[model samples]
Target chain A: MSEPTRGPKGRVEIKSEECKGCGTCVELCPQDVLLLGNDLNRMGYRAVTYKGDGCTGCGICFYACPEPGALSVYKIKDKALA
Target chain B: MARDTFTKAECLYDRYVRKTKVEPDQVSTHYCPGCGHGNVHKFVAETIDEMGLQDRTIFISPVGCSVFGYYYFHLSNVQAAHGRAPAVATALKRAHPNSIVISYQGDGDLAGIGGNEMLHAANRGEPVTMIFINNAIYGMTGGQMAPTTLLGMKTATTPAGRTARNEGGPIRVVELLSKLDGPVYLERVALTDAKQIYRARAAVRKAIQNQVENRGFSLVEILAPCPTGWKMDPVDARHWIEETMMQVFPLGVTCDRTKEIAPSEAKPVPFVHTDLRALLDIEDESEGFAPNRTHSEGVERGVRLKVAGFGGQGILLLGQGLAECGMGDGYEVSWLPSYGPEMRGGTAHCHVRISERPIGSPLVAESDVLIAMNRPSLERFLPDLVPGGTVLYDSSLIPDGVARSDVRAVAIPATQIANELGSPRTANMVMAGAFARATELFTVDHLKASLPRFVKAKATLAVNETAIDRGAAHMEKLLETVMT
Candidate 1:
């Protein structure tokens, strides 16, 4: 509905191999940005990459990442690009 | 709220036991000889009484030595599963948001089998408080080797002085759980001394206040003495807890969440009861999984992978980095850990399953891709490959170009590539880069967003950012060299 907040604060990073293909992230993303990736990664979790813009920095993504080290957020920086 | 002074300065027993004064009355505590559970309970009850929340609070008792907590605590409470007190607290925190729930668990209960749940609950920032007693031995279970047992300490299980080679090292639970973000308050105190007990009571008071003000998860781990198990006198027991356990689990607030997140300003967050029937789409048990967009919308490209390697191969993070890309792709997923004792010496293997379907188990039976980080793993798991699977092995590690028939094979000098790039650790990233080239697993754009998740918070912000780019390029060279 809105332009996705691409800032790293509230994003989810999927560790492709650790994914068990549970589709938990796809069903749970409130912003609906995470989806399974292509058949290219070593472990095909339909690894989650973004679809379009629409993420808030809310940590729902971080919570739902059951893979522990599989998914987590990074630092948010103030850049001129934004 | 100010600490209002009362005219009578009585002991904890009189003020909190449904009585007007502080002394032993109808409630007979079942603590062992020289056990610290009684003192810890006294401090907690007194704190509750002082706060005037005797009616508004709920107590949760653990299975170990503190099992008979209902005998003394004059409040609504239930005995929970061994090491599962955190789960009960989590449920209560979610259901009864306003109630102040306290979980009083022992070292055997909180730091052993229930270790993961405790860390996760703290990480979730549940509006609850926990009192973890670290006595170093399973007091209720006749002095077994608890997770917090001191190194080289003799126990029922570790008769030979708890060898580092056999039992491994003791887990520092407080320091480990502090890395998470959910806790509003965390402090580890020792009750072995008069000074420390007083300090512990104050910390407990602060933690309870945080809860009353609706602050999220507060944990206070106390190093209490067990004279009977340690085969020492009361004074000696306190001395042991102070000398041995304190060196490992230093007493202090791991995260002073009270300062960062004030509870007075806390409002009751909206609570949503999970609709399991609808979410599971369980019209009937016979139809196992509904194959529709409702449940199976994420992880379109289902890939189950197994990585095998040795300890020095830098292979553990291989599965993790790949899992990040999947998250970047907006896929539904889970990453399971596959580590065991064999990993300590020579061999290590991790099986990861990534898919669009609801995962029944974290264990991956067959793999779509197998990246053997070392020779031993290649020998161990070569036969377990699924049909039409792919193999990315280190050219230097593969013995006979094995599994070229059953699985599509590619050999890359991944570790060499990393050494050439000036970092041996990037070997795994280089392998990921090779997989990226051959598999088209995820676009570089998505992978770009996912790399930062593994960077440590204190620093590595800049090095990690630079490492990701370098990692991507090294594998890109492999793709270019191979394609030509």
Candidate 2:
């Protein structure tokens, strides 16, 4: 059984249902953090999967996705604030 | 459970599909994959949202790729005719003085076909913001040659590649518009990369801020990508804009006068009944003559008259006098003038409608009366005269007889009589007098009352007054002879 996991800086999360499987984000990722999955969504297109580590939260994938909500990078702030 | 971090764009609609669309399940736009319009639309929406102008904003979407702005913006939107966004935005801003209006246009829509409209609007300092997307080609029309097409760029229209010897050089719009004194802010920006996109977002916000602050005309020219039109991939198109288009259209704030120009505080024009009445100088019916009472003799319809002559022949003044006198007599009146481009010796005509009730249109398609001040005018307007209409022509100038047998015609030597009264310029006034006498629609006293109001010079007014009298006497003598 797989459990929810976190990466060092942040992880790239893809809305698998909304992805068009264009592979633009996979091709553009400098750290090789994303790849087109073998499985297809209900729309009959392959969804992108994260490589589970090495994401820098650069936001390049978010900008490159034609679909606005297809991808987002979430990071936890280091210092605690009031 | 990947922690619900990935989310939709803050500016985008909940669903990508327009609410008014018939296909409810559709959640996408008709724009090509990775089209720059989607990015630009997001920027505009974010600006409107951040500035709290969503409720008061009006987006004028022009023809071209940006015509569907209403489908996405989720604000008040109006679709303008091709290349007419600036003109439409100018009127919308003026009409709703408090609302923030934006003109969204593309290269072909703005610079190529709507150049004059954009130029005049900016020159006049219209208080509106404009978003110009320059993608170097006409994207909506299958990539036609645009005014901003690169020198060697090949488009649908320029199949052999744009050449300086034929297609001329691309236009630099931001720099060109910066020369104008009206615009308060002008900037050229790009969406090439994340850094450039951030800068473009600032420019977009500044442009909308200018309108919200009522500063004056503001424009942000955005160098956007058109991958499909450019025959390149989305990533390559972004690179092309940075590498190629940047060489032609440099990105920067071309002009910024926001600090110098103060915000406008003018109030919106009032459309209340009392205000309109005072503005138009419409007298109360009870305080003046009840003109429709005279038509108890059953003159059921309105009197539509067409007056035509050369530009300097007082044709418009003659029509104005009729409309003014009709208004004085408590009748609803309208006067519309048409003239040629030449200032003098140009063809001039006016339609005057005097109605007991409200006038439907100022245009007289089938005139009940035709006043031809010259031979050319008589021939020109003869076809528009209705059967049984009255034809009054200047006998001194027109040598031909009336051609229509069904109408009552009278040829008055109006110019000759005015010359005897010491001025040939009062011929139109003389004709006005003949109109009063022959039709008895308005009395000679009404004509006398309206004449003094229009003619400023004392001597000229006195001569015109005498000409009116003599002209009326001539028409009456003709009527008497016909009766005997």
Candidate 3:
């Protein structure tokens, strides 16, 4: 789980099982925070992953992602996770 | 403490249960990775959520890759035949004027096979939102050249390259539709990048909002990426749309009459005829004769009758009279007619079912009674008669009677009797009279009373009634001899 507790303005979660390694989200992410991981999901395709920090929560990646359930972008209201 | 705001749309199902047969994953769509359909689906779903149209929305999915759109969208879904989404959407919008109807179709489906349907539906100014995904190539059918395929574009069908002379130029659907006076809003957008996708999202919202306002037909043609079909990665496919596809299909609003046009009034409720007698122009005769509730002994299950003859022999009329008589007697009835091409000379047949209980199907594959007016009809339908069933034939026309001994064969010279009664067309009434008496399903008087409902000419009614009485008398005489 790549959770950003280091007080980033936002967080992005990538559901690995539903991702198909299309890299549309990775390429379109303005913060360059998303990447295709080496590990393969159950479907035998590399799934996208969050790079631990630096998510602006612009949600461009979410719109770019083709899979409806693969990406979730959240805007954190507070400085850090409680 | 931090509270996170979720950005995903709620209109999409949490789990796509309908897609279980295609793949094990419930969350994933059947579209290939980076397919433009997924992005468009997201936009539409989010718009539906934002507008609060989830409950009132009816989505018409076209044939092609997105045929399984019903599997993803949680709204009311209707899957149309290939290229027929516009037709379905028009009907849905007309029937449910308050509901938001959206027709989502692809390039090949909308512009190719269903071109005529889409054209006429839009021309009719039906207040329905249509999402036209123009990916340039037929993605679902394995990269075939679509009507919107750009010139010199290499596809499975156009392996070498698409040429203007050979395949003709790509169709700019939005531009073509802009020529029409019907559509209130028309825009062509792309899904090449975040900025273009945002434009597409806005266009989709506006198109749907136009329908919500009842401003008439609105279409958003989205230039979507087809990575798998284009043989490019997802990112490269997006770049290709921006760098190449936009040259052929420019992104812009071709028409915007939404602000000018007033919201259309709700369509009138489809006319229904509750008073069938008034609709059929028949006088109220039900009070004269009460419905006979007494059903025949063996016919408690139902009576399935098959009537067959030449088209001119009034075979269908005979069947209709039986069905109408059954209805008059308070029994559930169905009459289905099957006829060939020619109006008079071709073969004709009808299946009639009347029952004390509700009938399941109108088709009488194995009939309890076979009414044959010609020799061929008797020979063709003889095998389909149930064992110990009754066979009624026109003895004047069919000289060689039914060969089957398992069934009671009653030979009535129906045509000869009709000719004696002064008209040859009343032969069907004679057969109807025989049927009523032979089965004991209804009285001969009931059969005569129902004739005015079907018989149009008033002058021929007397002859038809006379033929029916004569046929019933002949059958009665035959039954008496058997009893003796």
Candidate 4:
């Protein structure tokens, strides 16, 4: 995965620190963009990580997260990348 | 993306109060894993914050796990009895029209115990929002069978899978609400998946928006997950809501008249005091009688008299006469009557309070004077008489058992006097006459003038007047003999 310093409006961010390893976002994400990482956070639960590069930022993952501030999406201006 | 890059929702409170007493440090939430209450709470709080309704919100939490809802939301929350959330919310909204009232209830509390309250509130088109969380079974009470429990579903109470023949059928709350004409918006949403969550959030927002616009009753039934009660994993619980619960309670907008129906003119009714002069049309007689210095100067408090007898003995009427006579003399008075189910032959009693100042309550537990017309009445009320209190009874009926050292228990031949007057019912008037002379509270003339309102028969009026005179004369002779 290409790591971007500044998340463009089209990208989505998952706060792996607060993720409960529920995998609800992974199963419900339409773009297949997220996956559970091998690493565990301070809460001792496996956190979700971004994988695919087609960043549409649909906000499905943001709404599905049970934990507060676990996911956030930024709308991208470029249509081609979405 | 990064770990710390996510932004918090603007509507969620910064911190939640710890609910459980044992875990004082557990500040996150009391909800079990996969429970939809946490999600719903976030959505509701966010909606209130977004709408700028934090100060105006009053949530009525029903008896369930969400009873601690006030601790979480940090708003003016009231805990209603089981199934009475809608009723409480209705009153709250009616009392304070500017406030936004929300009734949050669960399956068992709402559909099972509070079905009538919910139905009636919606039927009346009460301007309140309801967030109904239907998780199929009773989550708070270890998976008991709820009104919304699905067929063939196993719960703690229904160990052998729920049968339609035995457990009836699940209630479709959204469908039921949609059938009512008062509801402005009704929708059933679920928290099963991402797409479903989006729809649920929208539905909740719409329901609250309806209340804000004052558009009558709005209900949003949420198909929530209960993993512990369902005995399933969190993922499976979410899946079950989508697969099983949806089949029974379909996820959709059952009613939507937001645009068509205008906001109701349900303003709070201002209290208009009734003018006593116009309501009763009685002349102000307070200026006629001079205030008694003994009572008005606090040297004497007042008389708390209790009158007891058989129901047919006109005990209630005697007490009313005493109150009316005191009122006619420009004194504050109150009369309260009590009788059993068998109105005619049952035990009857009345409390009459007369004072220079306004009386507080009409219940006389410890009476200063007690007039008992029968043996049972004398036995029942003699102990409640205050020490040094005077008791008057009918010597003709109560032959004996007038033993008391502290109080003066006098017996008058009231029945014999009424028999002489050719009416058995005039016994109470005889007692009333003796009561007036013994207490020195009123004269026989004042007592007679108060009779027109209480006495119905004009023919018996002459006999009753003669009986009152005889009763007073008998008491006066007894007092003279005692003094000698």
Write down the RMSD of candidate 2 (Cα, Å).
Answer: 5.1
lDDT of 2 by residue, B309-426 (tens): 8888889999998888877777889999999987779789999998877888888999999999888899999889999999999999997777889988899998899888878888
* Per-prediction TM-score, chain B alone: 0.53, 0.85, 0.89, 0.81
Cα lDDT tens digits for candidate 1, B1-484: 2221211112233223433264434323445445677667767776777778777678999999888776667787879998898999888877777778899999889989788779888888878889988888899888999988878999998887776788878877778878888887889898654457668878888888888888678888888878778888655676777777788878887888577765464344564444565574444533322233233345456678787787656466767767656644544456776666664556666767656566677677777888897777887777778877888888765646765586787777776766765666566766766666566656654554556555335253443334445546655776687679
**Candidate with the greatest DockQ versus the true structure:** 3
TM-score of chain A of 1: 0.65
Query: What are the per-residue Cα lDDT tens digits for candidate 3 across B85-139?
Result: 9999988887888999999999999999999988998898888999999999999
lDDT of 4 at B354: 88
- For candidate 4, the per-residue lDDT at B268 reads 82
Best candidate according to lDDT: 3
Select the stronger candidate by DockQ from 3 and 4: 3
Q: Candidate 4: what's its TM-score on chain B?
A: 0.81
Candidate 4 stretches with Cα past 4 Å from truth are A1-62, A65-82, B1-13, B18-25, B264-266, B275-340, B348-373, B390-397, B412-484
Better-scoring candidate (TM-score), 1 or 4: 4
**Residue B298 displacement in candidate 3 (angstroms):** 7.7
* Consecutive 10-residue window with the lowest summed lDDT within model 1 chain B: B1-10
Looking at model 2, residue B165 earns an lDDT score of 93
Worst 10 residues of 4 chain B by lDDT: B1-10
